[model samples]
Structure formats: structure tokens, C-alpha cells
Target: MDSDEDTFDNDNVDSGNVSSGDDDFAMEVDISSSRERQTEPEEYHYEVLTTDQIVQDMVDSISDVNGVVNLPRTITRILLNHFKWDKEKLMEKYFDGNEDKFFQDAHVVNPFNKPNTISVPKVTKSTTDEICEICFSRNPSGMMTGLECGHRFCKQCWGEYLTTKIMEEGVGQSISCAAHGCDILVDDVTVTKLVPDAKVRVKYQHLITNSFVECNRLLRWCPSADCTYAIKVSYVDARPVVCKCGHTFCFDCGENWHDPVQCRLLKKWLKKCDDDSETSNWIAANTKECPKCNVTIEKDGGCNHMVCKNQNCKHDFCWVCLGSWEPHGSSWYNCNRYDEDEARAARDAQEKLRSSLSRYLHYYNRYMNHMQSLKFENKLYASVKHKMEEMQQHNMSWIEVQFLKKAVDILCQCRQTLMCTYVFAYYLKKNNQSMIFEDNQKDLETATEKLSEYLERDITSENLADIKQKVQDKYRYCEKRRKVLLDHVHEGYEKDWWDYTE
Candidate 1:
């Protein structure tokens, strides 16, 4: 009889394609026929074994040859011998497996490893009482089928298990298959196949993709063992991550370019970039340079007169104020302070007011003297007094009052020339003590009352003129007082009693 190795090799032969030229063709055919006699139907094989025939054959061969002596049987015997036989006790023992075998391949190894072959633990339909790994609940909905590890669990339990594992531990990381003693990672492809619902499959795929994406895209936590948090990419260029342990790095220094803590020394260095012009230029070249001192000045406004901040060479004219370290060379002018045209215009206006007021005062005094000389008659005197009272009520100045008195006197002179006899007779009758005197006195009294009422109650054009002149005089006086105070202060007499009183 052929040995098992030859039978296995013959079983693997491709029957459809035959190499006719080979001299060993007859032997190959005979071996193939014998292997075919030993083989069972494909359906029966599949039903009795795992999807992979090689794994099924290996398991069958190991079980047949070792009986109670192989690694699997030894693990089962060890579990039974070490613990009291109960469902929970058996599960706990089975789940832990043999420590030596479990930890033989364990270490902080790289995640990228070749596919591992796992020995399926001996689990029975009766031993399927383990709670769902996710919810830790005993109520499972359907029969459990594991990916490759013969670790069977309820379908609902397995799904929840995968979801929790993916969400918490993340993909590509190894997790024990839900079946006890079956230490196999539920990798991306296995997760996709086991999770049958369309939505769940998609979610698992997304999670797996996101895991790789996050490894590349997310900011890395500072590798400094004590640092806890990660920094984002946006804060990389200017403000770098600083650690409490005094380690500082630029935004792009680390693999993730993320630092949570800011460095005190790095912050100081960044601040120097703001203060030192050369340092600022090194960081960002577009900063404006002051023409006067050649130091960098940050441009805040639109004007071209760049002021240097260097104290020794702070020489730049403000185009707006025309004030700078050096004079404007007589070309630039500030009308408010030293413009000749405005100064001349202001002087001419002041001189005109002074000359006009002087002439007005002279004319006003002459008219007043003339009025005083003719104003002895009671009726005429009453008229002049009434006009004066009206001017005083309107807050008119003495000069303005004199002007009004002159205007009234001119009117009176015109009336006297037009009707001199009527005026003289009226005046004489008012003075005489006869029968006609009472009538003339009554007429004079009536005329005096009407004129007094007009003067006291009404605002005539002459009254308005006097009011305007008084206002102008008050304004001029106030201006003069202000100028005197300013002059006194400028001359170092600010603390004098007169200066305080003024």
C-alpha cells in the first residue's frame, strides 16, 4: 500500500490536464485512481469539514494519529485536570487555554505580520452557552459560525462582538476569536465575510478604511512618554506644540506634526521674531522696511511715510502731518499751523474789523453829543430815553446804543425841518399853563405813551442791528480773554494769582 504522503500528493493532481509525454504517466494515473477510491463526495466533505479541504484533512489526520496524545487533546486534558468540570469553569479554562502555548508568540511585535495558522479548539454544540462578547448577554438569536477558528458563538453575539471589538480596539489589531482558546485576529477580510448584513458589512469596511486613514491623516500624539494629547495640523506654522517637560518642536517636527503643550523657549523665540526686524524677515520676508533707519516696520496704514521704530534713527515724515525728524525743506506746508495765505487772510479780516469799529465809534460819539444838546424838551427827551431803555433791554453795548441814538436823532431832525412850526407850537403848548395847554398836554401824553409802547415792546430793524453788534462785542471780548490766558501761561506766569483769576 502507498504511504499517506504519496496518497496526499496524488490527491492534489489535476485530473483534467494530462502530460502525455511524461514517462511516469501510467504511475501517475494509477496513484490518482487509488486516491479517488479513498476520497468522499465533495458535498459530504464540505458538510463534515471546514471550507478549506487542506485544513480539514490536516485536522482529521492529526486527530486520527494522535488520539489522546496531540496538542489539542493535551490542552483538553490539562483543562479538565486543572479545574472542576462545570459549564462556566470549563469555559474559563478553555478561554485561557494553556498559558505556555498562548504566550509563546506574544510580545510587543510589529502589527504587520504574515498570516497565522491557528489550531481550532475542540468546542461542542452543548458548550455553546457562552454569553455574547459585546453585550455579555446569554440570549443569542441564531447559530454561531466563526470565520476560520472553530470558535462558535450565537450569530447576534458574534456581530455585537465584532462591532465592539472594531469600535474599541480598532481594526488590524489582534483580538481573540469569540470561541474560547481560539486566538485569531478578526482581520478586515474576515470581518467583511462574517458580518453578513449589508449595512453592517459596509460599516465594518468603513471602520477598517478609517483605521488606515487615521494612521496617516490624524495628528500624532507627542512621542514623549509623559505627554498625553495630540496637536492639529492647522496650528503648525506659527504656534508649535509645547510640552510641560520643556520639550518644544515646530508644527511639522513630529510624524503627526502635533504637539499639545507649548514650549516656553519656543514661544520666546517666536516673540523675538516679532520684535527683531531681521528675525521677522527670516520668518516672513514681505514685512515693510522703514526707509529712514532700514529697520522693518509693520505697515498698518496707507500713507507712504514709513516711520522707523529704532529710537536712534526714528526719522520719517508723516505725509499727513508733514512733521518728522527733518524739516519739510519749505516745500510741504501745513495751513493750520504755518500757511502764509491763511495767516494773511486772517490778519486782513482782523484789521478791517478794528478800523471799521474805530470809525463807527467816532461817528457814534458825535451823533450822541448832537442828540444830548437838543434833547432838553420833555417830548423829545422822553423819545430819546425810551430808545435808550429799548437798547438796554436788548443787551446792546454802549457803542451800539450810541449808533441807535444817532439814527433816531437824524429822523427827528428830518421831522423838525418838515414841520418845525407844528413841533415848536406843540412843545410850547406843553410848557404853557392855559386852556389850550390841557388839550396839548393830553395830545402830548397820548403821543408819548404810543411812542414808549412801540420802543419798549417791538423789535425794530435798529434794535436788531444793536443786538447783533452787542453779540459780536461779547464774542470778541471772550476771545481776547482766552488769548490773554494763553499768553500768560506760555510766558511762565501760569501760577500767578492774576492768571488764576483770569
Candidate 2:
């Protein structure tokens, strides 16, 4: 299960013509060519498979293969693992009727002539009993089974070996033959038959089920703490694929769904945020250097006249320009404005330093603004929620005030989305399309503010019903507006609609 094959390569699917429909939201691209669009709600649009469902799907896939070619399920699992669990490709490659290569490649001894059995190498044995390789017993008690690799061990020893591999060693489905240096996979046949412990067998099957999800590059375990769901999406569109678990994430980066900004920029932005670059940069910018020893010196509010603290280098220099302060003698604040040309690299480094800091600040400020606003809006929501409970004492149900809760939730989501958009926009190469996106972002921000205000209002006010209704309307408006902005950017990315400066 090589991951390189799972990388989202943009396939040459036909980019259908964009159709313009009844557009009212900010910067709407008309998908008119969609031709009689059906109202497919977002909730029902995708599939979410639990562990059981995923395992059942694999079973069904194997069953489909078995129907055409009567291979044992043990052989089938091997083939599936070999083909990275892609059944269609496996069938296409295997089912050309020249099947010896398939069996050989999968290392299944072809029993084509004697159809019902695996063809292991013939071994001379006494009519009495055989010696087990693992336990080195003379078949004293139980049954003995031989693998295709012709390694035979007593059933008890085999169970312990498989159990150790599955449970203690955590080998998953790839437990190998007991023969030393042999990589031949001990199939599920041997595992289930020889592994007599129900617990160990269950663990083996559980690990195999999880392996199919983990080893295959196309699937991901849901990041939710208690979630056991997996999502399947087109490999070509490796953007935000939402799970039914309500956890939307970038299939590309495995982080929470970051639209507009590509995974690379998101990684860079996050690393920049996490590090001390900003703090260190501020320090570096403010601190003066002792030119002799090149040591940093912070100003504690004095005249620009300064001396190097190092005893060896009693170099007197202007704190501002790092030039000799001999001309000014005692007090010289004007030295702070000293301007002189330096090396080319230093000048370029200074320019780049400023540019990087400014760029980061631009994105960070907007990100923080919407985030702070969302925090305040959430507080307001909690307050109003308390009011709803208080009103419940006056005979109002939680259902009756759920609209307030929903409005606040939508507001928060929209603002957070709007916050992330600024980071995306900051990296966006300025073009007509991005400019249009910015306009949409601005409009969404405006609508989100209005929604936040409505959600934050007092229940003590007159026309509570009207206020709630307005809040609902604003919620709908903000959500739709946010979707449009994101959807447009997503489309732009998918269709190569914009350029990036970075």
C-alpha cells in the first residue's frame, strides 16, 4: 500500500460549463449548464462508513471477485492487499483468463488441476506423525497444517505464534509464515483455523479491518476523539471532504478543512504562528548591536550615545546608527535618525525582514479580529442561552429558543470561516478573480456582524419573536454568504481560476 499512488492527481474529468442560476449572494458564479439542478442537501451528499460498514464493503468487494473467479477468501485477501484493495484494477489485471501469473504473484499455489486445495510442495512423511517446526514436538496431540511455503507446525504452536504476532507483536494482517526469513503471508485461513482463541482471532480480524482503512492511501481515520468513521472521496478533488461525524477536514493535509489556502501555505502559516519568529523578530529589530563583538544590547531609555558592555571591546557607538558617538560627546537623540548605507545583503535582508513581518501581520490581524469577534459572539450566545433558560421558567421550551442557539452557531462558524479566508486571501495572487473573492469576503463579514448583533440582543426587548425571526434570517443570510465565498474559492482552485503571488 504505497502512499505515492494515493496522492491526489488531477484527473482529466470534463470540466463542465459553468451555469449561472438565480444568483443573489456575493460573487456568484452561475452554474447554468448544470441544467435543472436538484436540491441536494449538504448532509446527504456524502457517504460515511463505520468500521462494520467498511469491513462489509470489503467483503462485498471480495464477494464480487469470488463470483467471477472462484478463489478462496484467503487468496482474495492477499490479492486485495497486493492491489492496494482496489478490486476493479485487481480484476482487470487478474481476470484475463491466463491466471497462473496471478497465483504466482500472489504466491498462492495454483490448484487449477485439483481445484479445491492449495498446492503445496509434496513432502515425504511417515504414516504416523510429523515434527512441528515451532514447538519441535513430534505431533504429540493436535492437528497439523502446512502453509503454501511448506512450513508445518502443530496447531497449538501455530495458535501461540499467530496470537503473539497479532496481539503482542501487533503485526496486523501481515503476519508472515513461521519459517525463518520467509516473507510469505500467513493468510486468514491459517490465522482463523490455527488461531483457536476467539479473542486473538477477533483481534486479528479487527486489525485487518483497520489495516484496509489505514494502509490504503485513499482512506483516513476520522480525527474525532470518539469517532470510528472513515470518509471516501474522489482522489482528484483532495479538498475538504466532510465526514458525517460533523468533522470536516482537508483530505490533503488532514487538518480541519482549510479552504482557499492550499495545504502548503496553511502549514507555513501555522508553523509561523507556532514559532517565536514574531517575538524574536521584534527583539532583533529593536535591539542594537555592539559592533565590535556583535552582541545584542537593548536600550533602557537613554540618549542615543552608548558604549559596548564587553570589557575587551570598549567600543563607543551610537545606539541608533552603530557609528562612533565621539562627535556628540554626551547627549545625542538626533543619532536615532542616523541613516547610512550598508552591505547589499544586509539591505536586502532588512527589506525582506520587513516584508515578511508585514505580510504575517496582515494575515494575523484579520485572523485574530474575526476570532476575537467570534469569542465575544459566543459569550453573547451563552448569555442569551441563559436568558432562554430563564424564559423557560416563564413556560418557554428549549426548542423554542433553539433558533437563537442555531443563529449563534452559524454566526460563529461564518466568522471563523471568514477569519481563515483572510489568510487565504493574503497569499492569493492579486487578480480579478481574487479581487472578486475579496468582495465576497467583505460582504460575508458585513452580514456576519449583523447576525452577531441580532444574536447578541436582549430577550427583555420588545418584539422578541420579530427579533428571533430576524436573527434566523441573518443566520441564513450569513451561512449562504459564507458558503458562496468558500464554494467560489474551491471552484477557483479546482478549475485553476486564480494565481498566487507566493
Candidate 3:
């Protein structure tokens, strides 16, 4: 039996095409080479991978490179990391360049061009008198360890150094040798064998895996809070990707799939909001500076006569005309000297400032309203589930009452789309196409509100069928209108029909 608080959750399906059971917002890219235009909206394709899977993929990449280069796995891993896990780029540079120089640039010794030196096993018990470069101690009983560079250090010093680098410094992929001037890197095998503490070892492994994911352009860690999954895409683009955790975000910028508004504009919009720069806009629109002393003043009273509160310059002026009050004398209440060029220009500038502020607030208010509504999505889902149970108790089957849940789902999606539309509209320049886009936004907004209202209405056995039909009709209309708006925006993008102010 499904609980009254059941939410929509699904596992990641491994497929070439992006699919989220009933979610229409999942985007996919068309990889097929056809000059003919397709009718469907563009979508993105990606895979959600677990941490263990990410590690395994890293190992597989190392193995693949090792297969062709015939190098040790440890050396292959370092080379792959140096190239940011790009196998093709690593291969290109490895075969086409000077092998010794390439290895030196990567800070790894070429196993093939090694000078004639004694090959002592790492972490071996010391038999002859040798001073550890790190500790500067010649211990007869302590173990000695070193990399291929042959600068041996006491085993105790190696553990301490590796622990500091891994646990304290957070260095994972490119940790150089413990020797002072040696640039030879310590491989994962040597690190694992040297670091005795289980916690440090695990942290080192995690850091390595995270670095692999972060450095690779094809991968992105899911931005959902507390989610451990990472998404792997074949190519990078500002396309929507859905994680197995049911969180959908843009693979490029990691924001919620904000169609209509491109990633760069959305980034600028977010920065503007976070900076709270609109408060200064409001100040500029509402308040004026004193003409004489230039002291900033806000008119709190309704009187047109204004006095500069500055101690040095107590100049009297008219608030509306910003003209000297001495011209009016006792007729200050009806100052007709408003046509002066200076005052006219001042008023014009203030009007322009107010208009700009009004435009920003218009879009910002709508965007924030939808964002606020989406925060209650879980409550809406729970309310719909309860209604579903009530309908079930009134002789309706469990499947029959699913329309309520589906309507809520569509309502939430509509809200998200609506939120992004305002962002798109905020930057859009006024034109015939923009007018049509606004009309589309209006239609979608109307249908979404109707659907949301229908979902929140109390359901009873008396009007179950009637409400069911109405809810279904409204949600279908909402979904249809949403698609229309998005499709128009996509068309605008392709045909260069839309223009931005910034």
C-alpha cells in the first residue's frame, strides 16, 4: 500500500536516450547526422553513476591506456591524470613527442630510460648504514622506503609524510616524492602501502576519485544536497540532465534546467540578485540629491517644498521641480516654473530610473513568486496523496486516483518553467516576438494556476468523478501550454528571433 506521503522517485535507467518516466523536461541531444530539421524538442543524454562505478571507470581508463602503452598500471594512472583523463589526448602526446621529455613534464621517471642504479625493493629492512634524507638519521633497525628516484627515507618518516600530504594537505593525484628536490610522483600503490591508518587511506582514495570526476569535462557531481551520484555525459552542453535521485539540473552550469534563459544570462541574473543591487536601484528611483550641497535626501512628507538638511548648505527647493524656493516666495504651493531645462532634465532622468526599476521588479517579483511556490512542492504532493487515498476509500481504485498526483506533478513542473520564463523575459528586448512570448507566458501561467487550484480543492465521494475530469482537463491543458511556451522559445533560439538587452 502506498503511503499518504508518497513522492515521485525513480531509479536511473541505463539508456542511450534520456528518459524520465513521465517527465517531459528531460532534454536529449540529436547525434544522428541529418540535415533535415526534426520536429521534437532538443534533449540531452547522460548516465548517473555511483561512487564505486566512478572508481571502476577510472581503473578501466587506466587499464585501457596501459593496454596500448605497455606501461605499469601505476605509471599509466599518473599519465592519464596529467591529461585530465582524456585518453585520446594522452595517446596523441605520448606517441608524437619526445618520450623522455614527456615523462619529465608529467613529473614521472621514464621506466624505459632509467639510468643504471641498484633496484632496491621499497620498504625493505636496512642492512647497510644509510642516512634517511628526510629525518637525517642512520637507523640500523628501521625500515627504509623510497620511490624510483632512489632517495630513501625511514619507513616511519614515509608514513608521517604521506599522512601529512593525504590527510592534512589533501593532495591526491600529484603528490611529489618526500625527498626535498625530487619531482618524482608517489603512485597510489605506494601511498596505499605506506599510509597505515584506515581513515587516511579511505580519504586519499576519495580525494583521488573526486579529482578524477572534477578534472574530467564529461563528468559532473549531482548538485542535489547530500546526493553522492555523479552524471557522465558524452559531450558538454547546457542541457538538462536528470539524476537517479530525481534531481534535474543543467549539466553545464549545474543550475535547475532553465530553458528560455541561457546559462550565461541566468548566471548574471543570479549574481545580480545575490548582490542585492536592486536596493540601490530603488534608492535611485525614489530619492534625489540636493542640487546645491548634493546631500542625498528622501522626501518623507507630502509637501513639495524641500529643505536641504546639510548643516553647511540649508538650501530650500521644490521637491517636484527641484528649483530654488526663493523664486516662488509665498506661492511655493503652486510653482509653475517647471519648464526650465535643468529641472526638466532632472525629472526625465528620475523617470527613466523609475521605469528601469519598475521593469526589473516586474520580472523579479514573478520569478520569486514561482520560486516561493515551488518550495511547498512536498506539501502539495502530500496533500494530493491524501486526496488520492480519500478517493480510493470512496470506491475508486488506487490507479483511478492517480490523476490527482499527476496533476500535482504537472503543476510543480509548470511552476519551475514559469520561474525561468520571467528570467528569460527580464533580459528580452521589446519586439513583436517578445510580445508573443509574453502572451504564451500569460496562457501558461493561467492554466497552471487553474491546475494548482484544482489540486488543492477538497475531494469527496460525492463529486469524485466531476473533480477527476476537471483536474485531468486542467493539468493536460497546463502541460500543453507549457510545451507551447518552451517550443516557441526553442524556435526563437534556433531562428534568432529573440534579442536580449544585455
Candidate 4:
């Protein structure tokens, strides 16, 4: 019969729907029915049989059902199957019946779980001619295999078989043992030990290790019948897969699989799943996309005139207000909707005389102060120069004359005071304060012209004494007038003719 037909036949027998005598007999002899048959004798049997006797009876029964050749094997298998006794303790108890050499040769200890060991029927060198059970090939050295019936095979052949199984059926899937009539599930750990170098091994190990972490929930292997690889879902909300084989991938990783790298599939999946509703809402509320490049951006403070970083299109927009280049007048400051005419009119209105009067006054006072400081510096320079000239005329040594001239030159180049005067004057003009000095412009021009001429003349050794006296007299007069002007500007002093006395 075909496998499907056989499976259907077995299902009929299992479900007790079949009416054959053999099927009825099989059901009657099954474990559940046997329990009913043994119930009446169970208490009496327990009373007569000691614990050891009961165990021996069980061993004998198993041996009778199988064969005498499998007596010890049946006993061991029965004990192991029934009670979860430590393998080591079971070995110790059972090996007592065998010779010391037999015990030593047959027993194997479990290293990881100590005190757990088992014994196999010793295969003497003479009996070691058995062929490798897996590939039915010659058993090579270093090969090891596990059997559901507790048999072992050559390590080399076992490795090859395991590799084939993993490369074929993969880990965590079903595969029968090499031994006929043995059906045990091969776990991933066994497969890993079998073919440590398989391509899937690394991925399997990663899945095993990371599976416990909640973040790795999306990591899964291809469930397709023939595929051996695993896939990771890049985004939990989106089911983006790399392969056209319908494998799911993480949203981020899935995007890489697209032709132009668009995450349309992932986006659709996310919308369907709605897995990131909270996160999406939060991001939408707090973040904005660049109007030009479509990149997500976060806004800090200030008016939301956002400039795009894309070189191709540097579109600026208000993030908070969602106003575009139109409102901002093509500039960040100009919101797309801002009325340029209205803004200009408002600015012009503010530029009227009264609005700027306070700024003009502030700069005017600053300019007067700066001029006073410049005058003081100039007076100091003139005094030093005069003193140097007088000392040079007294027939001072060359070193002394040089030192005086150096000091005078340094004072003359102390242009910080002059720079301050020029800056203040610029501010006065900028702020409309220069109008205050317009009336005296000609007098100031004449004073500057005279000062320039006086500064150009050199004081020689012969006329140094006379030049010194004349410069000192002029500096004193200039100092007194500058002090009066400064005090008048700062203190609102009466500007009478006596205040300007020479």
C-alpha cells in the first residue's frame, strides 16, 4: 500500500473505527486495556514481589518479549525509559554483573551533566568489523553517531551523515536515525555538533543565543520545505523580506532587497499590522520631513524656518507652522505667506525721526566721550614729545636721546584712542547723530587742518627748547577746553563763553 494509504489505514485502527478481528485484538492488548486486566492482580502482585523482584520481573518480561540476546539491553532500556535515573548511577548498578574489563570498555561518562553516564554492549576488536550504519560505507576513524536504540557508529561517517541531514533537512527538523526502526528527533545542538562548519551553523547559533532576548523575536528561519537559511524581520511592524521566496525580513534589512531600495512592501505591511502605531504617532507628532529631500528632522527652538540640506533643492519651510518658501519670501525669515508690502511699510514707519531719536542721542553722547578720550591721548603725546625735545636740546647722551624719542614714538602710535574716536563717529553717522555736529563742521575742519600741519613739522636739536615750550603751552590750552566740552556733554553744563576760557 502507498504511504498515504498506510497512514489512512493506521488512523482507522487508532481511532477504533476498523472492524477487523486483528484490530480488535490489538486494542484489547494495548496498555489502557491491560491496565484493566491487571487491576485485580496488581495489589496481590505488589504484596508478593519486593522492589528488586518487581524490577527483575519487568526485565524478564521485556527479555521474553524481545529475546534472550537483548536481556541486559532490554533491562537497561526499560529502567531508563521508566525512571529518569541518573545514567551514571544506572551504569554503576548494572555494570556490577559484568567483568571489570567489560565495565571499563563499555561505559561512557557524560562530562557536562556529571553523575550521568551509560554503558553500551562492548564491541571487542574482533567484533568491530561492523560497517558504518549511516552511509553503509567503511567506518572511518574519529566518526561518532547517536542511535535512538543507543547504538553508535564510526565518527567520520556520522559527521558526513549529519552534514547531509543539515544541508538537506536542516536543524530543528525531523530526520530518522541511521539504524532501522529508530525514530528520534535530532535537535539543533546535535546538528551543530555534527556539522559545526555548515553555513547554517553560525546563523543557528545566533538564533539560539539571541532568541531569548525580546528584541530578536522577528528573527526566524525560512519555513519553506527546502530552504535551509534564516531571515530577520527588519521592522516588527513591517514584514520586509529579502528573498522572492516569500521570506520575511526586518523592515530595515528588507529595504535593502528592493530594486531602488524603496520600502513600499514594508510600509504596506506596517500599515496592515499597525504594530508601530504608538511609535509612529509619537514620531509624527515630534518630527517633520524635509520638504525637499524628504528626510526626517527634529525641530529644536526658534521660528520653524527649516532649510533643507539637499544640494539639488534647498527648500526652506517652517516646521512648527508648516509655512513654505512662499510665506518666507524665498528666505527663511520670510514665511511663505508673509506680506512683503506690509512688512516694508511697517519698517518705514518705524524709521521715522522720533523712533530713531533715542538711538541718535545714545550714539551722540558716545561720540562726545570718544572725542574727549582722543583729545586727552593727543595731549599726552604732545607733552611727551615736548619733554623729549627739551631733554635732547640739553646735550643729552645718544642713548638718552634715543630712549626719549622711542617713548614719544610709542605714545604717538597708541592709536587705540584714535580708533575709538573713528568708530564712535561712524556710529554717529549711522544713527543720524552727525546732524548735531553739522553746524560746527567747518570749525572742526579748520581745527583738524591746523592740527595736521602742526604734527607734520619736525623738532630739531637746535630749536628743541623753543618747540618744547610752545607745544606745552598749546597742549595745556587744548586739555582745558576738551575737559570743559566733555563735562558739558555729560552733565548738561551751561554752555557759556566763560566755560570755554583759554
Per-candidate clashes come to 3, 7, 5, 21
lDDT of 2 by residue, 97-171 (tens): 777787667655554632333333233375456666677667632367767655667788878888899888888
Candidates by lDDT, descending order = 3, 2, 4, 1
The model with the greater lDDT, 1 or 2, is: 2
Off by over 4 Å in 2: 1-45, 95-144, 215-220, 232-244, 249-254, 262-344, 365-386, 389-402, 432-436, 446-450, 461-473, 487-497
Model 4, residue 37: displacement in angstroms?
99
Error of 2 at 455 (Å): 3.0
All candidates: CA RMSD in angstroms?
A: 45.8, 10.1, 9.0, 37.8
Give a tens-digit lDDT track for model 1, residues 1-502.
0011211121332211222322332223322322332231211111111112322332343344334423333222223222321224444433475644432333111122322434333343546444444454553234545544344556666667777676556543344577666554444444544566655554444342223223322233334443333333422242334332222334343421111112332243234334664443332333434445656555577864656778898677543332452544456545336445644554454456555445434433443443443343224434555666676677866665554343333333322222221221222222223234234323433343333233333455565775545434433333333233223322332332221100
Q: After superposition, how far is residue 502 of candidate 3 from its true place, in Å?
A: 0.9
Error of 4 at 403 (Å): 19
Where model 3 places Cα greater than 4 Å from the true spot, the runs are 1-43, 114-137, 140-142, 148-152, 178-184, 286-339
TM-scores of the candidates are 0.20, 0.69, 0.81, 0.20
Lowest lDDT sum, 10 consecutive residues, model 4, at 1-10
Candidate 3 lDDT by residue in tens digits, 1-502: 0112211112221111223333322111111111011113554567889776877788788778878988877788788889999999999999986999899988988888875444343332555556666677775533676777776777889989999998889888879988777788988778767788977777777778778888899999888666688999999988777776667778899998787689999999999888868888988999999999988899999987899999999999988888887776675444555667888898999999999999988888999999998777546866666777888889889888777766776777788889999999999999998999999999999988887777777887787888999999998898889888888998899999988898
Better of 1 and 3 by TM-score: 3
